[model samples]
Target: MILIADSGSTKTDWCVVGNSGKVLSISTQGINPLVQSENEVERVLRAELMPAMTYISDITDIRFYGAGCRDEMITVLERLLRKVFPAAVNVCVYSDLLAVARALCGKNEGIACILGTGANSCLYDGEHITANTPALGYILGDEGSGAVLGKLFVNALFKGRLSDKVRTAFEAETQLTMPVIINKVYRQPMPNRFLASLSLFIGRHIDEPDLHRLVVDNFRSFLVRNIRPYCRPDLPVNAIGSMAYHYRECLEEAARAEGMRIGTVMKSPMEGLVRYHSDI
Candidate 1:
């Protein structure tokens, strides 16, 4: 059996398959060795993941693709998975960007992007990444990501750039006061998540002109800063994430303006990932 995992900041999607076909599909709390300590990962596995794996013993290969999974973090996650999933004989971890490349582009070359809780991109030649522009964390960058969109919305609201009507609606919907926003942003443990939560409001109010402009501008920044540099005239661009999938119209407009075409926009990588791993 093979266990394939795709993880982001908010959650992890798991697929367990055998030689014949799929066995199970499940989700669990996301694990990022970059953020969570060794003990933290173990605790979550004990409490949440291990118990849920009914086919744990059958899993012979484990492939994990995740956000914040640098080489150091991959080593950390490998050790933890080895301890937790003792029955597994082989384990490998990869960055989530690779997952997008495989899922979106399959065995073809193109530009692959991630725009979920965070944002990232890479130029892929079917099997390997050729180039990548760093997706600096939300605070410093990650233009078209959920966290950055939320940050843009909140900043506009506070900076008096938005109209009184929009501001009033935002305050009421989010129930956020000046003090609360400050405390939530500065004192929060996962500020990126907190900021991303605000994106729901933007999505719901997408028809509003102000909010629409905000979304468009966010995608523009993504294309200009992340996608433009790696773009080739003939190569297609593809994305996988909640942000890109939900606001596809704006994303399309941005790409069109750049004289580029978007090839695929999957909300999550599970379906394509399942296909990609079937042979492996």
Candidate 2:
């Protein structure tokens, strides 16, 4: 059996492939290394993964692609995974970005972008990443991400940039005043995630022209600041993430305006990973 995992900041997708290359089971959970500690990751894996592997014994291999599995953290993550799946003979851990590259480009060269709770981009040359644009977490960077969009919406509302009608509608929908919002941003932990959650509210008002403009502007900024730097101006780009998947049309329009040709947009990279490994 082969185990493949694709993990993001919010959740992870797990898939088990049998010897015949047939997927036996699929599961999901909150196991983001960026938000959860090593112990917490282990606990979730034990509860969610161990039981799922019961049908298959003598697992042969495991591959994990996760966010926050970088530098020293990779060693720590590999150790934790080894403890959980002791039956597996081989295990490989890599950054979630590699999964995106493998799943999106496979043996082909292209630019890959992840647009979700946070944003990241890389230039993949068939088998490996040749160049990357740093994703400086949700605070200073993540320009075109959910957190960034939420921050823009809130700032517009509080500063009277949004019209009275829009502001009234937003307040009515959220039932949150500017002061409460301020406290959440300044006093609470994971403020970026908190802000990103506001995208749900913005999503509700997507049909509104003003709101639509705001979304387009933010997404465009994301492409320009993060993706365009590593991607050649004429390069065709592939995207993977819930944000890019759900808003592909809008994102494509924004990218087109910037002279970028957009290709596939996928919400999950695990499916593609399964295919990539099957060929191997």
Candidate 3:
């Protein structure tokens, strides 16, 4: 059996494939090594994931791709997976960026990007990442992401950049005052998730000219700052994440404006990832 996991900060999607090609899908709360301690990760694996598996001994291979699974953090996740799946002979931990690259490009050369709660991009020559642009999280960077879009919408709303009608509607709909918003963003945990949640409101009001421009500009900035650095305009830019799938029209417009094109924009990488791993 093969077990594959795709984890974000908010959720983790798990897929188990048997030798007979039977598949079982499960969901669990996210396990990020950067934020969750070893005990927490172990608890999630044992408590949530183990319950979903019918035969743990059957899982001989485990492939985990997740946010914050880079550099030294990779070791942390690998140790936890090994502890959870002791019978597994092969356990591979990799960055979420690699998941997007493999899922979107699928052994072909292309620029792969992730635009979900956070933003990240890399140049992949089929098997490995050749270059990457640091996302720097939601505060300093993460352009074209849900968190950044929320940040921009809130800033414009409070700063009078948006019309009174929009502001009034937003305040009425969300019931969030500036003081409350500040408290959540500044003093709360997981501000990125909170900010990304506001994308729902943005999506509701996407037809608004100002809101449409805001989304387009955000994607344009991402292209200029993140994708342009790769210097490969001839190749199509592929993306995998909620933001890319939800606001594809705006993303495409931005790409066209920047003299580029979008290849594939998938809401999640699981479909392509499953295909990629199945062939192996």
- Give the Å shift of residue 136 in candidate 1: 1.0
lDDT of 2 at 181: 90
For every model in order, what is the number of clashing pairs? Answer: 0, 0, 0
Clashing pairs in 1: none
Using TM-score as the measure, the top candidate is: 3
> Total backbone clashes of model 3?
0
How do the predictions measure up, each by TM-score? Answer: 0.91, 0.91, 0.95
Candidate 2 global Cα RMSD = 2.1
For residues 1-32, write the lDDT of model 2, one tens digit per residue: 78888876666788777767756665667566
Pitting candidate 2 against candidate 3, the one with the higher TM-score is 3
TM-score of 2: 0.91
RMSD of each: 2.1, 2.1, 1.5
Give a tens-digit lDDT track for model 3, residues 1-280. 8899999877999988776563898999997899989998999999999988987988899999998797999888888899889999999999899999999999889999999888999999988899999989888999999999999998998888998878888888999999999999999998888999989988999988989999999999999999999999999999988999999999999999999999999999987888778878
Instruction: Give the Cα-based TM-score of candidate 3 against the true structure.
Output: 0.95
lDDT of 3 at 29: 98
Q: Which residue pairs overlap in candidate 2's backbone?
A: none
Q: Which stretches of model 1 miss by more than 4 angstroms?
A: none
Q: Write down the lDDT of every candidate, Cα atoms only.
A: 0.87, 0.81, 0.91
